[model samples]
Target: MLRVASVLSFFAGLVAVTIWIATALVEHAVERDASRRSLEWAEFAVWHVPRIDDLAQGLPSDPAELAAFEDLAHFGGVFRFKIFSPDGVLRFVSDDPGSVGSSLGTHNEHAVAVLTSGEAMTFVKDGREKPDRPDLYSETYLPVYDGDRLVAIAETYMDQTTKVAAVRTEYAIVGAALAGMILLALLIPSGSLWVMFRRLRRTNAELEEAQVRAQASDKSKSEFISTVSHELRTPLTSIKGALAMLESGKFAELDGSAKRLLEMALKNAEVLHLLVDDLLDFGKLATGGLEIRPCATDIAGLVQDEVDRIDSYDADRQVECRYTGERGPLFAHADPARIAQVVRNLLSNALKFSPVGGKVFVSVRERCGAIRVEVKDFGCGIPPCDQERIFEKFTQIDSSNTRQHSGAGLGLAISKEIVEAHDGRIGVTSAPGRGSAFYIDLPFCEGAAEAGAVELRNVA
Candidate 1:
C-alpha cells in the first residue's frame, strides 16, 4: 500500500507539472498575438493623431485641440490614453484629467527610452487583479518623433477582452479533449498492455529464431572454407609447382606449342593459388583467428625485399618497381610476416593496374613517429567515389579498365586488417588518369633514424 501510494504521488506530481507547462504555453502564445495587435494599433495612432505640435510643447491652449484629444480617447475601440512630454511629465490623461501634471516616476525611464529610440513597446494584461476594470487590455507606449527630437510618448490602452477570451477558450477545449482521450486510454490499461506485451513476445521469438539460423549458416561457411584450404589448396599447390617446373625448361624440354600451353597453365594456376590464399586470409580475418607477432624490425628493408620480389612475378604488366629510402633502417614494432603480406598485396595490386612497361614506385620513410610505406602505380586511377569502399572485402569498383583485372577483392581488406592490428593505419590516394598511391603507416619503434633519399629500380 505504501509503494502504491508513492507511485500515485509521483504520477500526480508529473500531471501537475504537465498541466502548468501547457497552461503557460497557451498564455504566452495569446500574449504574443495580443502584443503584435497592440503594436499595430499604436502605429495607427502615430499616423492619424492630430495635435499640430501643441501637446509636445505643453497642455493644449486651443479648446478645439483639447476637444480633439478628448474625442480620440473614446473613439477607435481605445480604452484610455495618457500623453507624456519629452521629459516624462504627464501632459494629459483622457480618463483622469486631474492627475495630469505629475512625473511618471518608475516608468519614466522606459517611456523616455522608447520615445528617444523611436520604437514602441507593447504588452497584454488579463486585468484580473484590478477590481475597478476586470477586462483584457493591451498597453502600448508609443513614441512620437519630430524630425531628430523625441516630441512625446503616448500610452494607449485598448480593449482586447473578446479576442483574448476566444483564444483562451479554444486552447482550453483542445487541452480538455486531449486529457479526456488520455483518461479513456488509462481506463483500458490492462487490455492495451496485454496486447502490446503479446506482440513484443512474438517479435522476441522471431529474433531468437533468426539468431539460431544465422549461427548455423556461419558454421556452414567455416566448414566450406576449411574444405577448400585443406582438400583443394594442397593438390592445387603441388600441381602449380609441377607446372612451374615444366615451364622452367629443366624438366622435359618441349617445343613452342607445348611450352606456350604449359606457360598458360602455370599462369592460370598461379592466379588460382592467389585466389585461394586471399579466401583463406579473408576467412581468418573474419573469424579473428589471424594473429600479429610484433617485433622491432627494419621497415625499409622489409619494403625493399618486397620491391625486389615484384620483378619475379609474371603478371599482366611487366612494370619496373623502384624502391626509394634513406641510408638507415626505419624500424617499427610490427609483425614482419604480416607486414610483408600487406606489402606483397599492394605491390601486386599496383602491378596489375599499371600500363604495360610502366613504372611502380615503392617508398619507405619515417613520418611523425610512424614508419610509412607507400606503393604507387601510374595506372588509370581509381575514382573519388570508389576510393571510400576500396578497402572493403569483395568490393570491385565499376570501370572498364578495372573489369579487366580480377580478384575476390579481399587483398586490400586483409591488408587493412593486418595494419590496424599492429596499431597502424592504411589508405590510398588516387585520382582518375593520374595514378594511385596505397600507403601503410606503422607506429615508429626505437631504431636507426633514416635520412637522404636513394632510389632502387628493377624492371621485370
Candidate 2:
C-alpha cells in the first residue's frame, strides 16, 4: 500500500511540474515578442516626428496655424502625437487641444529622455489604476529637429497594451491546456493502477475462500481415512493370524502348491503391515504426535548401527562409511532417535534409487560454526525442475502409475520438518544423470560441536 501511494504521488507531482514548465515557456515567448513590437513602434514614432514639427514651424503663431496643427493631429491620430515646447509645455495635442497649454507631467519621461539625448525613447505602462484603459501602453518621444537647432519634442503614445493583454490571455489558455494534458496523463495510469488493485483484491478474496473450502475438504478426507484405517486394522489382524495358522499346517499339511500360495499370502500380509506403518507415521506427523526420547548416544555409533541393520537385511549389497575432518565420539543437543529417523529416511531413499553396484557416501564435517552432514549417491539423480518440489508432501519424482517403487511419498517431507525443528536446513544439489548430493547443515551450540563422525563400516 505504501509503495502504491508513493507511485501515485510521484506521477501527480510530475504532472504539476510539467504544466508549470510549459506555461513558463509560453509566457517567456509571448513577453519576448511583445517587447520587440513595442521597441519597433517607438523607433517609428521618433523618426516621423521631425517632419510634422517642421510644417508647423513655418506657419505663423495664429488661429490658422492652430487649425492646421489640429488637422495634422487628426491625421496622426494613430500615434496620439502631442508636441511639447522646450520648456516641457504641451503645444499640440492629438487626443484633445483643450489641454494645449497644460503641463505634460513627469509621466512623459520619454519626452525628456528624447529631448536630452536628441534621440527617441519608448515607455510602456500596464494598466493598474485605470480600468477603462488598456492593460499595456507604449509611448515614444522624438526631438523635432528644426534645421540645426532643437525645437519641440514630439511624443507618440501607442496602445501596445493589446499585445501584452493578448499574451496574458494566451498564457492563461496554454496553462489551462497544459493542465488538462497533465491531468489526462495522470488519469490514464492512475485509473489503470486503481483497476489493477481492485482486481487483485477481488482475486485475493476468491483465493482465500477457495483455500477455506479446500481445507475443510482435506479435514473431512483425513477423518474418513483415520476411521476406515482404524476399523480395518482389527479385521486385518485376525485374517493374518488365520493365514499364519494355515501356513503352519495347524489345520492340515499343505501340498507344494498350497505351500507356495501360503508363502505368497504371508508376503502380501507383510506388505500390508508396512503400508499400515507408513499410514500410522503419516497420522502421527499430521497430529504433531511423533514423540522423541533422547539419550546420551554416540552419533557415529548409532549411524553405523543402522547401516549394519540395513546391510544385514541384504547381505548381497555393500555399504561403506567414510570419516573425514575430526574422527571421534560426537555429542549434540538433539533427540538422537529423531535424528536417526532422518538419517534412515535419507539412506532408504538413496538405496531405492541406487543400482546394485552404486555407492552411497555419508560424510560429517565441522565448518563455519556449524555441523554439516552430506549424503551423496552415484545413482539416478532427480531432474532440475523436480528437485525443489521433491520434498513437498506426498510428491514423488516417478509419478507413473506402473512405477515399481513402493511406499508413501512422505519420507522427504517428514525428514525436512524434523531437520527444521532441530534448527537445521536440508538441501540437495543435483545434475541430471550425474547423481546428487543431499546436505544437512545445523548450527553447533556451545559444547555440542562434536556431534558425529563417519567410520569405515563393513557390510553385515
Model 1: which residue pairs collide? none
Give the least accurate 10-residue stretch of model 2, judged by summed lDDT.
451-460
lDDT of 2 by residue, 220-307 (tens): 7666756766777787788789889999887999899989888778767865764565556566767677775654445555566566
lDDT of each: 0.77, 0.65
Candidate 1 on 349-450: residue-level lDDT in tens? 898888899999888887887888999999999999989798998888853564788887889899999999998999999999999999999998764333
Which 10-residue span in candidate 1 carries the lowest summed lDDT? 451-460
| Model 2 CA lDDT for position 166 | 71
RMSD in Å for candidate 1, one decimal? 14.4
